[model samples]
Target: MVNKPQKTKLSSVISLSHSESTRIFEKKSDLEVWSAFDKGDEMAFNYIYRGFTPIMFSFGIQITNNVDLVKDCIQNIFIDLRRKRGALSEVISIKSYLLKILQRELFRSIKKESIHSIQNIELPESAFLIEVSHETKVIQLESETEINTQLKMALNQLTARQRQAIVLLYEEGMSYREIAEVLEFNEVKSARKLVYRAIESLKQILKN
Candidate 1:
């Protein structure tokens, strides 16, 4: 289990590990991409789509626990983003904006699914991890699989928001400012606070 200080230190590591010098994409900023897209640059739109889709996919799968549903929701999200581009407000960080949209789309799908089902449908924690690990274990051993399963169970014990925080802060390697923007926090400090709280909860949950 990662302690508060250790997790806080890990957060810094997570934030800094990604090299700012590396060119992950040619485009500089979302606003720049948006401008090019507005000018009818299909390639610019494609670039944005490619950059954001994986994050959206992971987030969607986590919240909804339905692969097809996640695909549908993400498609719809891009459609909506395109449709609302003319009225798109100033966003501090494009990553955060995309995350917020993905979360909204995921929740909407969940609500719809709930209404359609007469009985409550409970999705296990780290459902996306299950999908990814399935193929990995096929090439590996049973003991490793068991350990991975237990780790996923540990992750499942976290609250929904905490899970989200941990994923964004650790797995996705987003900065506190970016997470703050995604979560609609007034400041980055609040975002850090959320992550710290989530980490503490996860440590306690995993320790037991």
Candidate 2:
């Protein structure tokens, strides 16, 4: 198993990313960064990697069972981006674009292996990782254990795609268009519909 980074350090990294992610991701700023990145800007490249690497790891292990493979894929994605930056297409959301890369890379890795065994072995752990924050629940145990359980239970009731859509829509604050692009859907409206259906399913799961 590839070592998952400690939550404390990941939290600090994400905290730092909040401002940098915001600044570089503003509407005009995104174009500026991409323009600079395309022209072989090392600072721009480092900024993108530092800002995204942590969450990308968390997201990747869900898509593929092999943590090591996920780690390698992450590096490969960035390396390819750096090498081909000049020919890259303009994108609306860099986060979404990066997510698309992660998903595609994971899919490629999965296809080359014996997927059935890996999927069966890893699905439960990966699903839980995505659904419940271990650190969040620890402090909340005294006050809100039931709420936490309810969320995990509700998330468990979802299909994997539904769970992914819900997380992207609510937690990541991605718009439908961005989600459509990341998920490779033909239309943005489909992404919105999927999220709505996931929300309704969660409500039904919690009710019952």
Candidate 3:
């Protein structure tokens, strides 16, 4: 059986990294840091937690407006990581892996909360929200104002899954295979199709 770290120990492990360790791990690749972490290196764990927390929280908040719930879910995943580090699999992109875990954990927590609360909760299928910013590098248009208005409209027309696929592809810089893994698509082709459909829809909308 895999031994999980106790809460107190986990907290200490996550919180107590030295400056030298941070400097050392900062120069290491994700795989190296992750390998060290899996081997029970607290410094690597701290490095990961500190590095990824902002982006993870940003991704989580886009899925749902519940700030407290997003924070809680982020906290829980790190705890789970520390608890199950020994059983963790090899990871290529730590960002993609953590985002994938966060997405799953957010949905799972939302479902559980919905069951116990009297108020109806927004399901994962419809909950994803994104604001297409002025500096968006993926979609280029002839005019700035035209870009913002039309792009926002086009994005709004997309299903939650498609919008998410686009963000993961463009905004997060994930490969099709990574997207498939994160979105739970059975194959990379599914991820490709999703992004293709989404882009085609955007083009058609913008052209009109």
Write the residue-wise lDDT of candidate 2 on 35-134 in tens digits. Answer: 7778876556656777788878877777766888888888777766765878988866778888888888777667567645453222333442344654
Which run of 10 residues does model 1 get worst, by summed lDDT? 13-22
Which ten residues in a row are the worst by lDDT in model 3? 118-127
Computed on alpha carbons, the lDDT of every model, listed in order, comes to 0.63, 0.70, 0.80
Cα-lDDT of candidate 2: 0.70
TM-scores for all candidates? 0.65, 0.75, 0.84
Q: What would you estimate as the lDDT of candidate 1? A: 0.63
Q: Which stretches of candidate 3 lie over 4 Å from their true place?
A: 1-11, 17-22, 116-126, 140-142
Write out the backbone clash pairs for model 2. Answer: none
Clashes of each: 0, 0, 0
- Please report how far candidate 2 places residue 156 from its true position, in Å: 1.4
**Predictions ranked by TM-score, top down?**
3, 2, 1
Please identify which of the two predictions, 2 or 3, would achieve the higher TM-score against the true structure.
3
- Could you give candidate 1's per-residue lDDT for residues 53-165 as a string of tens digits? 78788777776657888887676666656656566676546677888877766665676757475344333454433222544432243457676676667666666666666
